[model samples]
Target: VNCNCDYGCPCQFNARPTDGTCRAVVAWRIDSGHFGDTRLDGLHAVNIYAWPGAIHEGNGSMQSIIDERASDAQRTALVAILQGEGADPGAVMLQIYRTMCTAAHEPLYEPIHLDIDIAERTARLSIPGLVDSAVEPIRNPVTGAPHRARVDLPFGKEFRLAEVASGRTRATGVIPLELANT
Candidate 1:
């Protein structure tokens, strides 16, 4: 999924996480896949955490976690795809995950929880010990009104618009995501 991290992520600014450095964890479960003749079925999850001095500079480190149930071939294919291989160029999902990463960590196997309700402006992503992130509409302080902000990237491979707001977050392994006063 596409995300808004301050004005410029290290990748965009040729730097690290907007707050001086770069660090984030991205995990996903593939419901289905077919890399050539290889069948990738069942539930699979992977996590990527990284810290870069500047995203464009390309010297950041990263950690990858994959589901233990995957076969050796499946694991290799997923890693390659996540690392920006075999996919179309300019595919933001793969490109962004790859270019900005500098260091690589061993993959882990674990359960990941994910839920999304774009229409309701709510989303949650979490892992037992790795991450827990949530997104919702921003609210007005005095009236408790929900404020909504959208960033449109017409050419971006991700969504064209993203709602920014104040959200509650609790992430330990990666940088904590707290939607605050957007």
Candidate 2:
């Protein structure tokens, strides 16, 4: 998730979004996964979305992008999963988010660039014309040293735990998402 949430990301724990609203950039690099017979391995999926109030508030909008390298079966499966169409009700984070969205723009198929460095607490993901986001270690304002932190979600839905850090996102497409220092 790369939208405009605070550094602590209150929304991760069922709390209100830091900005009184939610703008989320959900992305993934599926090195290995599957949707039934469709091998979704080596695929990338990204979704940009926004809501006026909390996530519980419906009528939101979204734009999805998938790896163009995917085959027909892979594309269809990925899109359906991203749209939360072929899953058990509320089973995953995407499924829940799908129920809250009202408008889904036409999906984009394009090459994706993704890099993840977990030990360094850094990542970079870009979908041309849609979003450009980066995550890095949080810095100490006074000393300018990299601040270290982590969040351990023992019973989490999206992730079991996360390395807390500073992040920024610039979304210039239909979703219009933006996040800074978080």
Total backbone collisions for each predicted model: 16, 0
Error of 1 at 107 (Å): 1.1
Error of 2 at 49 (Å): 1.2
- How would you encode candidate 2's per-residue C-alpha lDDT over 111-156 as one tens digit per residue? 8888888778788998787679998888999999999987898988
Stretches of candidate 1 exceeding 4 Å from the true structure: 1-4, 7-17, 29-33, 39-46, 68-72, 87-93, 157-159, 165-182
TM-score of 2: 0.92
Q: Which candidate is the best by lDDT?
A: 2
Best by TM-score: 2
Each candidate: what lDDT? 0.57, 0.84
lDDT of 1 by residue, 16-81 (tens): 455555455455656687677777776556444444444555676555556666788877876776
